[model samples]
Target: MGRQWRDGRGKLVVRGESGDVTLPLEIASSLRARRRGLLGRDFVEGALLLSPANSVHTFGMRIPIDVAYLDRRLRVISVRTMKPGRLGLPRLRARHVLEAEAGAMEGWRVRSGALVEVDTDGGSDAHDRPDSAGTPSLPS
Candidate 1:
């Protein structure tokens, strides 16, 4: 599989039963109209990355996915997937959450404590802050 982001561009080439699919990073990373899984079985086209201590709502997804919860140092705290239309409760010790397509973590060899680099084209500084709505937020 190809890396999804490079120089602020989304580099995904999704191959499904129909054909190849390509999407820009802007469209791929935004959490607008997306859902969050509480129990770790819900799936969505995209994920709203959350810190371990934050809450989330999952809705409107085409499939289920695995949620990789990370700690303050980007270490894996727990991993689970929520079914569509679920809610992930807050975990006091979680640092971040990664919502990957089903089996993506295993396929990419991603594990707890893996360092994730955020790439941007406009050269914006990496900002880690909660959104005004009180959700864990990351820069796109």
Candidate 2:
């Protein structure tokens, strides 16, 4: 992500050793969007990224999810799988939170220490635009 990201749809690109993983991304930069994240969604087509957040809860969620906490530079500080009705502790170093269907992070190669990029300029022809470095799937 950049210094500033607005609430919208975008793309998340993970730079893995094997290759780059690009997935659909929903950005929740505003307080309203971030607070209502994935609460009623049965499944996430890709992933939801909440900025300026260090923790999350699945109080009203319908499915389990994989959560990854990211630091300022977009480096994943930790990743965990959380079931519905559970609460995740805040990571002191985390500046953002990523949520996806349970187990989707493994398939997408999102792990601790991984780096990600957010592409908010996802148009018909915007691919591999390294605006800056640092930035999932459905449930059963």
Candidate 3:
């Protein structure tokens, strides 16, 4: 069987004004993976990429997180820091959701309008075109 998007375990490179920020990313595309989310994790070193998601909730979380809603073009639509027990409103234009530690988004300059790239092959360079594996660059 082909590798599923849900099985994605790679690095995410956010090319921002400050420079390039590289971090690990766990992609949640499958129903089961999406449902589980980061519920049990006390801390996340990198971030989680939830495909086909427009909303998220931290109902049972232990810490706050920074969430970025991205449109189909991979352009960030909005960014917010949410605390535990809070339910995020759905974004009509969001095709994906990116979640990371509180304040991490700022450090990475991952605000609205910024683009995100993913390297599933453990590469160091960030490409605006499709990845070497032929996966179209993150929605864009």
Displacement of the residue 139 alpha carbon in candidate 1, Å: 14
Residue-wise C-alpha lDDT for candidate 2, range 66-128, written one tens digit per residue = 999988777889999999999999999988899999999999999999988878776422232
Write candidate 1's Cα lDDT for 32-100 as tens digits.
Answer: 222333244444343334322344445665566667665554445666666666777876766556666
Query: Candidate 3 overall Cα lDDT vs. reference?
Result: 0.80
TM-scores, one per candidate: 0.47, 0.86, 0.83
Candidate 3 per-residue lDDT over residues 1-140, each given as its tens digit: 11235556888888777688888889988888888888878899889988878999999888899999987656789999999999999999887899998999998889988888766777643343335564444432
Write down the TM-score for model 1.
Answer: 0.47
lDDT of each: 0.45, 0.85, 0.80
Ordered by TM-score, highest first, the candidates read: 2, 3, 1
Better of 2 and 3 by TM-score: 2
lDDT of 2 at 36: 98
Q: Top model by lDDT, which number? A: 2
- Give the Å shift of residue 58 in candidate 3: 0.7
Backbone clashes in model 3, listed as residue pairs: none
